[model samples]
Target: MSEPGLPPFESIIAGLTARPLARCVVVAPHSVEAIAAVAQVVAEGAVLDLTGDRARIKNLLAEAEVDVSAVRIHDSGDSDTAVDRAVDLIRTGDAEFVVKGSIPTADLLGGLLRQRLPGRSACASHIYVMQLEQFGGRTVLLTDAGVNIEPDLATKAAIVENALQLYSVLSSARPRLAVLSAIEKVSTRIPATLDAAELRLMAERGKLGAVDVDGPMPLDAALFPESAVNKNLAGEVAGQADILLAPDLNSGNLLAKALVGHHAPAMGVVLGAGVPVALPSRGDTVATRRHSFYLASHLTRSAATSPNGCDRE
Candidate 1:
């Protein structure tokens, strides 16, 4: 049976209505597409333009009926510089978050890591995109597909941690994790299965925290209780995962792409930084971009307010 009480994306936003406004400093505010999206977010009380462009910048300020002089226009040469400035603003509490605009993902993250923004959580930090899978009234989070290439066991653990941190903000309890692989049993040759075993042991030993971690499960068994029962899988997380951790980037990318290709409603973001970063692709629909911005804002507002940065919750 499908889970009950699974809320839609809009309902999640509505639930957060009582939270304070989310303030963000965008890296590039001039790209017509980006600016338009930012404008909509600003209108919704979520972002502030921080790009150094004067002409388009002035127009946005004017459109908002805010004084141009009140905003600072830094003559940063590249998106990296703008990202650096934005991260600084976030760290100093001048802004609550940062957004990637007209910049390569590398540049944004390069500046962020080099600048030691938000107290530098860990060098092994990773990114995760959450897909809300509605089944039997339940929402399942499938992640690490939009970010992270091929990751080793340690990196996989970190990626799972990063995703779970976001789940904590979105839900009331800890999440159940399914480490995906081609089969349900470990073998000597398949590295994913071996890693899955280790990850499950890590969870059992409390190294992976309160999250329930199970792995080496086929995708079918990961999402459908009937499949789990058919396979005689004996665990709560086997077919009822709150978070689906992909084995590698190729799998993750393909899975997310397949969902979108099939017309599944989804939103994505880069997590594990000091704050949530909206890194939507240029090819995404305006609605997807806007929804990503909303997800990022939700993550930023609920992110822990400590300098240590890494979140175990």
Candidate 2:
């Protein structure tokens, strides 16, 4: 049976299997784990283009029993060139998304940003879909944990907008966004609270689309009904937020790490770009990476079909 309040894992896998192959480009595909990730997705009908050292990639493919005929191999010789080639494919609409391999995140993102795909947002951000057992199988969306150091009000607005887009694709219900801050009250000393107030107003004014956004709420009040009552917080988003908009990268990163460290199942993707970027950490398990692939594929398909392009459900 499917978990309450969350889609079943088997259903997600089945959805992925039903879709047509998503064209993917892997940059710096040199490590054994990277090769295995690519192979796993390829078996699911994703057409892959592995760019990196020619001899090394070919040798790894041979060892993994990945058929050379099934994938396109691009010999870029180095990480920099490999990233460039992958970005070029994205620019030309030949690839739906790019997967990070053995290359540094800076290198891969740098190349992608330089190309500046047409549909790219002003700022790119990361969002993690986390399923914590402690949360009673609820999936929480957390943002800007992997990117954006310390965003200002305007940047935070964009981050929320980007996350809302992804949330719309994943869930059928209207998203309730809790803009997280240290406290629930807007104070002059706390810039995050001020920003949260502005964001809430923006959503109320219909500037941020269809999400029910509330802000200046603490984490506990945002996720726990009892805490919300104890704090005397009264809002639709309190204790029922589908998304958590973090105050900054440090807070967001720490929250996500704490959940994962406690063995919560999580997957993440990069948004605000022309294509969804599957960005699993280097230390992530193969299962995590594969799930990220499925997430990206679903986002890609959903975005393509949306008339307003990820901005509407």
Candidate 3:
């Protein structure tokens, strides 16, 4: 049976067949985990272009029972070069998105940044979209968990904008954003609280576009109405945030892992790029990887059709 807050795995795979399959470039695709992820996505009808050691990747794919004829392979000789080649495919429009394989996150991101791909945001951030069954089908967005380590105020704003853009694509309604902090009130000792306050002001001044932003809100208050009331917080976003902007990567990463560890349904994507980036952790299960690909595929199609398209140069 499907989890209450999440769609069934088979349903997500079936849904992909109705749309044009995204051409994905996988960097350093030789490890068992990476090969498994690729094969799973291939089964769902995505076109995969792999970059890595050709012989090794082929062997691994064969071992995984994936039909070699279906995938396009690019032999880049080494991990660094494989990542570079994958970025080039995205740059040349040969692929719709890039997925990390056996390569390190830093190396993959380095190749992409060096290419200076058009439509890339000033600061690319990571967003984890989580579905909590306990929340009665609520989808929550967490930002900068896997990318930005300690973003400054300007970078934080950019992160929020990137997340908001992606959320706008995934959701029909304007999303309510909660800038997370340790407490519900601003304190000079806590820099994040101050940053959150300023971010809220930015939203109010029409600087952050059409979104309801609240800040310095604790996690409980952000998600639970009773907690917000107990804290004497009264606002549309106080207990109804669709997005939770983490103070930094540490907090965001911890929060995301904790939820995932407890078996909550989640998927992550890197925003602020020419194409959507599916970045499932190495430790993530095959189910999570497949879901990430499904989300990235949908986002790719949505970005292409959006009025303010994501592929703008």
Best by lDDT: 2
lDDT string, candidate 2, 46-128, tens digits: 67888899899999999999867778988898788998888778877888887888887667766676666667775677898
Candidate 1 lDDT for residue 134: 45
Q: For candidate 3, which ten residues in a row score worst on lDDT?
A: 304-313
How many angstroms is residue 170 displaced in model 1 relative to the true structure, after the best TM-score fit? Answer: 1.3
By the lDDT metric, which is better: model 1 or model 3? Answer: 3
Error of 1 at 173 (Å): 3.0
All candidates: TM-score: 0.83, 0.89, 0.90
Cand. 1 Cα-lDDT: 0.66
- The weakest ten consecutive residues by lDDT in model 1 span 304-313
Return the TM-score for candidate 1, rounded to 2 decimals.
Answer: 0.83
**Number of backbone collisions per candidate:** 3, 0, 0
- For residue 153, model 2's alpha carbon misses the true position, in angstroms, by 1.2
How big is the positional error of residue 12 in model 3, measured in Å on the Cα after superposition? Answer: 7.9
- Tens digits of per-residue lDDT, candidate 3, 156-265, equal 88888788777776656777899999898899999999999999999999998888899899988988778889999887787777889998888999888876675577
